[model samples]
Target: MYETFYGLNGKPFSLSPDPNFYFASRGHQRVLSYLRYGIHQGEGFVVVTGEIGAGKTTLIKTLVNELSGDTDFVIGQIASTQLEASDLAESVALAFGVSNEGLSRSQIFNRLQGYLTQRRLEGKRALLIVDEAQNMPYSTLEELRMLTNHQVGDRQMLQACLVGQGELRARLQEKRMEQLRQRAVAFCHLGPMSQEETQGYIKHRLQRVGWKGRPELHQDALDSIYSETQGIPRRINTLADRIFLVAYLEEKEMVDRDLVTEVARELAEEQPSASDESEAALAGTQKMVSGQGEELMEQRLSAVEERMGSLEKLMDCRSLAKALIQSLQRT
Candidate 1:
């Protein structure tokens, strides 16, 4: 909307994870190096974890785009969505084009194996990149571990890369996930950009879309952005987008500290107030206490219903067996 006013080509602070807009902060560069190293190693899992909006997804995407030219590599990317083991298996099968619809688990595995083997024989490597992997169930993760077990004469056929939020590292540290953790050949965590890096990041994105600096941004405005967003790239983008829009509407050629302060205050006001949060917490506590009795009662009733269902099934089975025995005697 403010493109013409700003005399720019396009939106500089778009929220989409576009590779073209990717900025490699120091931590992100390390992450990219680890990912490249993992791909070169070609055998085990590579895991990358970061906080929400830390640009881990964008980093992987940019890397994939850079690596897309070779016929000797196959990259299959899928975003996890709280899938169960079978569903995750199906997703992987579909991602690698394994024809898994209506197939049994064994059949799906067979198809995946066949595909991986075909790729390997063609002098190609296969890598599965799972995004939002923290939502992956333990069983599904175990299934992924099993898939990585596919090999061709002692060389691994399929490689797996897991990208997820910070909690994913915690999840992997659990005792139950030790097996999967042990198989990781590379691990990296992406952190927020530094204050200076944050400023550079904004300029980098702006320059990408033909920004000619018509609206001069003051250093104080950049400081305010870093303070408000804690140097997170996505947060910076969102706030800067708003600031730019406000600047365009006011027809200002300069973004000063005062304008940033106003915008920041307006954004703060848009958030829930302390009183609202307190009242919400109080209401939630009250509701939980009020519903406790009913919840317990419902749970007991459900247990009884389940027991009755099992007993009825047992009785039906016994009746069927008795009827068959009597019928045979009569015959």
Candidate 2:
């Protein structure tokens, strides 16, 4: 919505992991290097872990884009969602475009091996990228390790990259995961961008979408955004998108610290924490009780006023009657 107002070609802060908007932050660059090294080796596994929204997907997408022209590599990607051991083999097969319909577990494995062998014979290496791999069970990971056993002499027919959250690192450290760990050729943890990197990241994305500085971002505003989002790329994108929308709505050309802070507070209020929700509920209950008490007090006061009014009218009638009787006697 704000793209036209900001004189941009597209949404700069979109949450979708587009390779065009990939910013080479320090951590991302390191992990990307590791991925390149793994691909060059063409054997074993490459493991990458990071916090949610830490740009792991973006890094992988960037790598894929760079290798798009290479005919030697065949990449297949899948996002794991708590897949069991038996289901994982079939999922891998499907990801690589191998039909495993009506196939048993062993049949699926055989089909996958045949597919990898074919690719090897064609002089092209097959790479399987498992995203959100922290959701995969230990048994599933062992299956992946077993797939690496399909080798032609010293060269393995397949390589795997496991991308997931930080928990994947912990899982790999467990005693049961020693075999998989041994197969990992490169491993790296992608961390959040530094504050300076965060600034560069925003500007980089903005420039990518044809931003010519019409809607200028003040340094103070950038700092405020970093403070609010803690240098996480995804968080920054969410806040920055909202900030631009607010600026466009207000018809402002410059985004200042006050504006960033106001937008951040609004975003926080929209998604309150559990403790905040509880406190708000308690305050609402107290207000309702207080309002009820005030209503009851007003009703009692009205009743007392009506009774007093009736008594005053009765007293006035008695006085007038007494006065008439005295006047008649005197007459």
If scored against the real structure, what TM-score would every candidate get? 0.84, 0.82
How high is the CA lDDT of each candidate model?
Answer: 0.90, 0.92
Which digits, one per residue and each the tens of the lDDT, describe model 2 over residues 68-155?
7899988889999988887877888998899988989899988988998888988999999999999998888997888777897667
Residue 91 displacement (Å), model 1: 0.6
Model 2 ranges with Cα > 4 A deviation: 276-331
